[model samples]
Target: MNGILSMPGRSAESLVDVPHTLEPPARSTLPPSAQRSLKALRLSAGFWFLIALVGQWLFAWYIAMVYARPVLSGTPEAINNTAKITGYIVGDGLGNSLLISHVLAGGLISMLGLLQLWPWLRRRVPGLHRWNGRLFLALGMLGALSGLYLTWIRGSRLSDLGAIGISINGILILIAAVLAWVHARNRNLGQHRQWAIRAFLLVNGVWMFRLGLTAWLLLNQGPNGNTAKLDGPFDLAWSVGCYLVPIALAELYFRAESSRSPTRQWLSAGALGASSLLMALGVFGAWLMLWRPHL
Candidate 1:
């Protein structure tokens, strides 16, 4: 009887010792399915981000292409010829400088923004990422300030509202970017990641806004005569939707870090997947509209 009792204790001791005897698997030993799933998720996010980045670049390119000749030509006739019938001008020299700065900054931001989507670039080249981020922030600030200054000079109500909306978003982006850098300096990586994500989303606001416009026009079968008129209702709707959606998505991702429940995981994954899809649709749709022209 004593031997039997001792045997149970011995067995328990042996079980505890067994774990100690074996080495924990290195990261290389992570299950294949888990690794693959991680890879898939990253690839999906990268793919969607690239789509958004490219779409934004193309739009910027189109704007530059349309305005470059006129702005660079520096002739009175060219200066007076606005991109749109209702477009506003900021006189000659200042307007030309603003236009040139806007296009160049936009192009650089779009290109650098694409590189930031890659995980390796973010992790391995953090110094480069940080420098680029600073440049982007500075340019974004310049763009926003310039945009606000030009908003008062916009010819149409819709254009004015668009400028204001973009300016507000640009400010938000700058704030987020600043916060991200601050958090990173303090070593609060979670907050840094969240703020960085928010900044990136704000940077993509133009893409989202353009898509919203195209959808509105398409659903209406064509633009109404007063479509260029910025009504409070349209401006409010666009501002709320574009700003809230991505922030909400980023929050969902942040929350997923602490959640262990399968349901929460499902919800997080669903939100991420949905956001990725929306981003892709917005990007591709905008590209088709801008580039194809007939669409």
Candidate 2:
């Protein structure tokens, strides 16, 4: 981030975009049949994105139903929606809209994840890639802004310390998004890649929240004790842990990739692989124990 540090933060025009030409993948020059098969296997360009987006849209649809039904029908009971915790949250048309927007947009943000992670797509379709990158940054900023308002002003039931953690979470997300844009503009792909990954993980911090909190509930034999609702210092701890740990892990991965040591690379690969598996397990844990039941 020395490059980022040296660049003036005050001016949006400070970063000069030095166009860098990246070499096209060898797979692109392969025989037509071979290249075609790669797409079928989702190894070529961005074809797998269709599969990923389908899953995300389905998830979004479910969330839309979960939250929207209560608000639309003017249902007095909280029903399956967590937003129904306090009647006041959904009482105002503003809070109701924000909750619905946040839930619906969550899956779309996951779609942006597909773009940032896939390098081939950007090479194949630079125009679409540039447009979507801008869209991703815009929506990401909006999501964080609205989330802060909903969490703090509109009352998300977070404890004072938990709320502070959440506020910091939003700020980090916003900062990461801005930094990604700056680096990308400067053609600093190295810095851009790292900052983009950071932003991606930070954007998905809520998933960590669900996964961590749900696992705690399961281990403690239901939502008994401080785990029941967001109470005590546990929420505060988990709120920060969810994002902070991932950010630390991202930095570790960046450093290992930059290093020349094969041993370090191997260790970093193993650790990241294990972390991905754990994250998948956490998703399942949350789905089985929390969100699915709400449906």
Candidate 3:
């Protein structure tokens, strides 16, 4: 057998002459902490996004319902001014008509605003989204221009500030929307998406203000007790807070996602957690006051 193995055509090192031991397969070696951290990040991101969406929707619905009917009745000065402004542009006898039209249009657009966040809707309804977006832009321009005219004619110092805040926000939203459309047309999806997010947040200003007021009132005991009236510095502060806070949050979230740095991610997450806690406290206080009876 040894002579055969040593033959010219056969080598002694061949499988026929030796047994080889196979090495065991290498095992995955990820540390437990790394795995846990990834899971935690994913959960945190999902939770934060959900909170933003739900909070936005609730505020939108409340505004649409409250303003739609009361503004038509012409009971409050604020509501009266809104109605008169709408009426003045078109004509008298059209005050309620204009109010209804604005509310209905605003409500429809705001409703779609929520859907724009959905990945599927954003992809499938790009054209429809763009069209509705144009309508929203037009509505904003008309509303803001009319609001400016009326503000000049009838706004109080506080009302003037409020009107200016809303108008500025409106103009910003219009610019952002237009830029988003242009970027989309140029196939610059990243910039387009960013601009769209900004526009959507601006459009949500009124909703945010309402929520902030509701929150403040709750914390202070009730709407009546809440000293922060819908005027003057309070109104301006509310508007600024609503617009700036969300944008700040979105920026932090984007930064965290891009950096992939644990420190940044944790910092952003903590800020969001604190803001959410404060909002929760406000909401709880408001709910308690709203439900409680007056002695």
Best by lDDT: 2
Q: In candidate 3, which residue ranges exceed 4 Å CA deviation? A: 1-45, 55-98, 124-143, 146-150, 153-158, 222-229, 277-295
List candidate 1 segments past 4 Å from native: 1-44, 68-82, 85-90, 153-164, 219-226, 232-235, 291-295
Q: Which should have the higher lDDT, number 1 or number 3?
A: 1
Query: Which candidate, 1 or 2, has the higher lDDT?
Result: 2
Q: What would the per-residue lDDT of candidate 3 be over residues 39-133, giving only the tens digit for each residue?
A: 34444544544455555444445445556555566542344443323333334444444445545555665556655554444455677767766
Could you report the Cα RMSD, in angstroms, for every candidate shown? 13.9, 10.8, 18.0
- Summarize candidate 1's per-residue lDDT along 1-295 as a digit string, tens digits: 1221234433211211011122223325556644444333334444445556557667666655555555566542452343443342456567556656755666666666655444445666788877876777677667655555555554323555545666678678768878977887887765666676677777667657767656555555666432445444665567546876777866665554333333554566566676666666656666666545521
Clashing pairs in 1: none
TM-score of 3: 0.66
Candidate 2, 64: how far from true, in Å?
3.7
Instruction: Candidate 2: give its CA RMSD in angstroms.
Output: 10.8
TM-score of 1: 0.71
Instruction: Give the alpha carbon lDDT tens digit for every residue of 97-209 in model 2.
Output: 76567655675675565565545456667887777778777777778888898877877754656667767888998999999999999988877877776787687777677
